[model samples]
Target: MTANLHLIPLLPLLGAAFSLLFGKRLGKNVVTLVTCGAVAAAALVTLQMTFILHHDLPPGGALVDTFFEAPWMKAGDLNLSAGLWFDALTAVMCCVVTVIGFLIHVYASAYMEHDENYTRFFAYLNLFMGAMLILVLGDSMPVTFVGWEGVGLCSYLLIGFWFDKDANATAGRKAFVVNRIGDFGFLLAMFLIFYHTGTLKYSELASHIDGLHNILWLGLPVACFAGLLVLVGATGKSAQIPLYVWLPDAMAGPTPVSALIHAATMVTAGVYVTSRLHVVYEAYPQALAWIAGIGALTALFAATIGFAQRDLKKVLAYSTISQLGFMFVAVGSYVNGSSNYASGVFHLMTHAFFKAGLFLGAGSVMHAMENEGDIMKMGGLRKHLPHTHATFLIYCLAIAGIFPLAGFWSKDAILGGAFAAQWDVKNAGPVAAWFAMHAGKIIYGVMLTAAGCTAFYMFRLYYLVFHGKFRGTHEQEHHLHESPARMTVVLWCLAIGTILSGFLGVPESILPESLHHFGDLLGEWLKPVVGVQLHEESAGQFLGFAFVATAVSVAGIGSAYIFFLKDDGVRAKNFVATFPRLYRVVFNKYYVDEFYNAVVVRPLRGLSRILWKFFDEIIIDKLFVGGTAAIVNGFGKSVKYLQNGDAQRYVVGVLVGMALILRVSTHYSAAHAAQFHVDQDGHAVTAVPQNDAYTTNVRFKVEWGDGQESDADSAHPRGLKHQYASSGTYKIRLETTDSRWQTTASRSETVVVR
Candidate 1:
């Protein structure tokens, strides 16, 4: 069974390869069936693997199956091997990938059947699924990045799958370019780790932390830098901060792609990365704090953006971002010295169920509308598409965290983790440390506010799309048939997951000791990876907290129910008419997008244009590039004088050079002799003195005009050969006058040696 785990992701990879290579010859329906069948087979195999894992592994055991390693790379001391890790986290993630992915693929087959590009869509979908599965099951970060980049490439292809449409192509490019921003961070972080640790293997890096952290000044700073880089990667993949602009636009693709990538699979990579690096973050709480802060802000920001969206899928996109924000919050809470791995991973599971359902239901709506997605044009759909309406209703309640549903369980668990994180600070009683470490009053407040907004906006979308009378033209209304049985069947299955998945991580308070046994199944399973902690909140406190959280969620639902479902006037008009400014602000998402466009995008474009015009074209050409040309020309002209080829002028120049050299040499030698005598005898040594320190003689062979050699054996007159017994100076003089034109010319020569 352990070895069989390798087959899970491989099946989809094979299916993708076959579909892409021979899909056109196979025909669209065959392609769809083949891909779907392959993924379904993979899901079944994963199910068997999970069952075996449950039966075989102990409470805190991980089943690591390294089936193959091709020795990808190895340097002097660094080695990285490609393998798979099918531990608790991998098991849970694998189930989600194959299961949810299979559902989405099935839904897409039916939803996309009308399109001519159905075969291509399934190929991309399978490829994307395989890449994501590999990402989760990878044993090391490099292996994970391979899958990371694979998914991004698949997303760009899928998002732009309908490339004939300009908007769709632009949306695809946006997803690609924006994600690159985060991928850059991931690459840089890998380099930093490789430089310091000399290895990229997760096990080796984990064990060598002490060595890396030994230089607090160097290590801490580098750790923070690396962590921040990884977070940037997370933000891009997960759609945080500036990177989130692409997700809403991503709806330009088919609704099913949006559902699969944005809701269930790709965006969650950030949270997965953060969790995988829990140890790295544990060593640096400050980085974790930053993570939590950014996540909380993104949640609130995207939720607010959801309020203003008119398109159904765009609203869900923002909603996905907001929900991901919660995951980040859970991760951040763990960083504050608490163990909320169960809570964060718990929320991740439940979120997948509900979000995937929501997206699929949205797809069904679009399918019925002849491809229309705006909620304003889609009223009175509940009665016609009863299955979609019913499934979507359950998903809405779950997502709104309504009582007893899966969303309520998972979401409140997250809030409970947030509260647990801030317990000591808020309690201020006996558990002061827990309170101080965990309490984030401001974060909780914002989260609660976002929760309210989520409830209101979701119900608003629900009512606008399903509750009112049909608003489309007669022809459009005539086409409003239910989605295919294949789509509906998957929707129902996902609705069940949305309804019951939370039970896997059931709060211990709900199922007391001896039977509070959900703990060992996932909590203990993930203990080796996420380090689960058995929460000790009293049963009474747990009930009280659950009750209050449920009450608040219901209140949000009730408020939406009254405003949209009951009072139809509020739905037609503005609910916040009394405060037009506030309503407008809420509708505009506080203009964060506009601000980013103006402040960030505009300036970047302007600077890029300026750089292209000035530095790249003008300065670079003129100074760095053109200057070389100028220097070459100047050298050519200066060397032209040497090419005159006049032998007489060359001879005169050489004689002048010889006279200058001899005069300079005589002056330097006399000065040296004078200095030696000045230092010892207070007089000059006019001859080569035997007692002097100058002993060795150095001779030069000179070349004169027209390549003629000077006579080396010639001796100066009057013992003026100038030899020094030691290292000192002497002068050589040839009798001559100082006049250049007296009779012929009185020649003189001066030579010096030392």
Candidate 2:
């Protein structure tokens, strides 16, 4: 348990570096071997540590490795670290990342066998896993943020692995930019958390955040503001709303990238972070309610979009977005007035299983059909690819929440938790939570309907892709066959996992008294870190809600069977033609991308063009960059003319320069006379010196009417120099000359022949 934690992230990172540098030299096979082996090793260590934690430590115990003997980062009260913590929570995430990541890598070997950039693809995959592990195990927010940004970078790289394709590159940039909005919110939450609590460590924040619930920022609690910022990050990363336009477009990448980044690990980062910092949302029910509402709505919204997509991966893409919404709902629910974020993690794990399986199964279909991603071009695939068909069937049922499959248990837990959650939001200062007070039932209903939608669209995809008569070209039908053993084996493994992983979060409500302890195993494991408490509802009430969840899923499944499988999908097609406008709306994903482009992207781009033209080209380039060079060049040209060996020209240039200087430069003359003090006979003019001028450049002496000179540097004043010119007027003056012109002139402006 005290093992070096750095190895967990470092191994995959090193694998990435090694493969990238030498992968081409060593060949793709060797590169694949090293990258896969690195993850497998990390997975083994994570499992070993998980076993030790389970067997040796008390419930909620964690093994923390600071890596260094002392704290790595500290400044006044703001102490941070590059440490890793392995608790039950981290254990679940680590296993999901490494194990699933490894399988995806293995599957990719066969899936990408003929690709030329095999090594680059593996390198990005390795980098992604390493970053994800760091994110899961980091001991502090800063440490987690480092990993957070790392995965974002890796996603951009992996998603656009085929950079030659414009669409793939655009998809990568889209994900990068959208996540940045989320990351900014996350960064702000970190700053706000530190400002209020003086610490960003999860261990320290548990006690510190409770004190902030009463503190107000604006009109609402400071905790609410921080929680909202964190939720903003979650929505961006988890593909919730507004910012979710990027996830559906991410299908432009290779299938493994989709399965790895979108399905299993990278997209789940938001749920992981929220669950990790669940304490911040604890005291502010309004904040929690916001996340819950958004989650429920996004799930439903994405699921509806799924119903109209023709692309195999696009349907699954929307399904992934929809499922992410469920995880958010689970975390935000915080059921029964207690933190139940671990239930969200439970869904995250189960989702990694079925969703990854589904994506890979889709990949197998594409593999058999010559990389055709459109389900319209695919049907009767089940006949040619039986193993893939069987395994895909299991994943489909599991995702649809049918019966006791993996999706059913995890999704059922979330619905039950959300159903029981109490927002107490009536007292909230924010208007957003007005509907949250006693609104958990409505949220639950929305999630239930979304779950049903999930089943319908997934099966619609399944039926259209697997059940109908061969709709592809005759050449594709002739060559259609099951994928290689390497791929089919991974598919079966994931499918089996989708079946078994659900049992980890089995609700006690459905279990016998003797089996109650095992039913909530995942929840109990997270008790030490999250301390989530489930409300004990009567068995009948819990079972009744469970029945409702199951019935809705079954209804969706049955409906899909009639619309697609029973009548060869004629009804679905007829509905599409009859309701073309409505179908087009959903089919076009409600024009969200177009809306964003018109509203946000187009305006921003137009502004950018203006800035480039005026600010950059005119002000910066023409005025600054070009202006400075022009000045220097003009000076050089003039100097070169002067430096030409012509004496007459030089003499003329100096005279012209003097005349030009005289014309352009203005000169001002100043005259000052000391205050006159009259003598008794009025014959002598005595002068008192004015106070010394307040500048270092001024030093002076006064002259007396006796025609005597005085020391200019002396501190005392002499009498003013004066003589009666006409009646009583007197003036004094000093002589001066312009030596450069060799001319003399009167220096005094007051010398009027006095």
Candidate 3:
């Protein structure tokens, strides 16, 4: 069964290829069947793997099956191969991705029925699922990156599915580019891991973390830098503070895409990575602190912005960011010398259920209202779309962290983890421990406040969309109808998940004494992989945190009811009027996007324009390209005078050359006569002087074009002979010099050396 793990991701990849190749000819129904059926089959395989891991594998054991391996790349001592890994972690992720992915696919079939490019949409969706599965199940970071980049490409395609619209296309590009920033961080981390550990395999890397810490680059530990870089990548993928701007804009994509990618799978990749490499992160406490701090801040920041969003999906988008921040907090918080890795993954699982449900419900609402997305323009929708309203209400409660729902259990666990996180003042010196304790308290407070804001905003959206009188035009009201049964059925199934998935990770304090060990089931299941014992808090402490969480959620919901349900928007108007400046800031998303444009984007664009104008246009084009052309033209004009094609001119040039050679030869023979004496036979004779006080040795050498050189010698003062190794044009030179070597002259002529 473990050997069949490859099928989990391969099935969807094959489906995507088949749909892309034959979708148009196969027609919509066939394409839908292939797409949905493929994901469903993958989901079934994942379920079987999950059962095998739970029943067959021993406690604290993993089944690693190398399905197949091909050498991917080798650098020095490091080798990477493409393969699959199956364990508790992979099993959980596989189930979530394929199961929810199948639901989204089924929902999209009905939602996108009228679109002409329906097959194309399904193809992209299938590709996204396949890539997401690869990302989850990859045995090495490099293999994970293949899926990472694949999902990024599929995200770009799906986000801008309607490329005809400029806004949609721009949104897609923004998501792609912003994610690239994080991908670069991921790449750097992988390089550093390989550099320090000499391996990229997850198992090997984990084993080598201790060895990595002993190695240092510059003044800091290598593991610290690698952990930080991985966090940067995670931030971009998970939609943390700085890189989160792309997600709200990603709402321009089709609703099913929003549900699948933004709400469920892709955004959680960072949490998965953080949990996957817990050993490395545990060694660097400061890096984990940064992760926790950034996550806490983003949760509060996005929750505040969610308070002011009018668009339905935009609110959910910010909510997704906020929820992701909570998950990060869970993963990063090191309470009592251990991080709550399972709590983070548990929240990731539960957030998928409720957040995806909310998005799909919003899609149903939009479908009913003729594609109107503004919740402000929608009201009293419960009468027209009862199924969507019911599912939406449950999801809204789940997100608000109402008791016993998925969000309540997961979110409270995160908050509990934050509360449990404390500094060991006894071990640490006073000053550092003081700061740690105070920072933990501050983080706890901020997360609590963010949780309140989350509940408030979600209920505000709910009341505005489903409770009040119809606010749209009469024509929209007349056209309002429930979504198809297929869409509603997905909503109901997800709502059920929202209601029940909480039990999988029930807090021990809430359970009876006999069942206490059974609580935190997910934590126990994941203990083999994460290698951390779940810390048990006092029952009183658990009840206390649960009470605070429940109170805040109720307060948030009650406040929304008072503002929107009781009064017809008067309280909300009054509140906004009272705090216009603050409201404006929240409404504008703290102008973070604007600030990024003015500070980052505009400057980059300006620099690019300057480079294009001066460097590209003037320097490259005019100086190099245009200069070369001008030089060529000038040489061509100058050489035109020599192309007269006259035989008389050619004879005159030959006669002038012969005259010059005869003059030079006569001069050379006369100058060297003092050193040469002629015998009676009139042969040239050279004399050597024994008393050489007044003589100087002058040497001359000639190079023939055909790879032969005359040796330097004083034997031939006037000229040196050389042999041509082959037939070619040769340059010949002659030299004349006095005994003192003070006066010398040489000349060269080009001639055929055939």
Give one digit per residue, the lDDT tens place, for model 3 in 1-754.
3467788889999999999999999899999999999999999988987887889878755555564454556666656676777788777778888888999999999999999989889999999999999899888898789888988889888887866656465456556656887999999999988888877777767678876688777956788899999998999899985677678888888999999999899999999998888878766666788888889988887787777688999999989999999999888778666687888888999999999899999999998888898887988998999999999999999989998799998888888888767643335677878767767778888899889889988999999999888899999999999888999999999999999888888877768999988888988888888766445677888888889999998988887898777878766655546444442344245345344334422343344345435643565446544565678799888667655688787788899999999777555432442332211112211122122332345444444445555534454344334444556655554343443434555545555544
Residue pairs in candidate 2 whose N, alpha carbon or C atoms collide under 3 angstroms? 60-528
lDDT by residue (514-577, candidate 2, tens digit) is 8887877787778777777444556787778778988988888887888777877776665556
lDDT of 1 at 636: 87
Candidate 2 overall lDDT versus native: 0.77
Cα-based lDDT for every prediction: 0.70, 0.77, 0.79
Cα-based lDDT at residue 60, candidate 1 = 43
> Which model is ahead, 1 or 3, in terms of TM-score?
3
TM-score of 3: 0.76
Flag regions of model 3 displaced more than 4 Å: 67-76, 168-170, 423-431, 533-535, 575-754
**TM-score for each predicted model, relative to the true structure:** 0.74, 0.76, 0.76
Q: What is the lDDT, from 0 to 100, of the residue 275 in candidate 3? A: 85
Could you give the candidate ranking by lDDT, starting with the highest?
A: 3, 2, 1
Candidate 2's error at 467, in angstroms? 0.6
lDDT: worst 10-residue window of model 2: 666-675
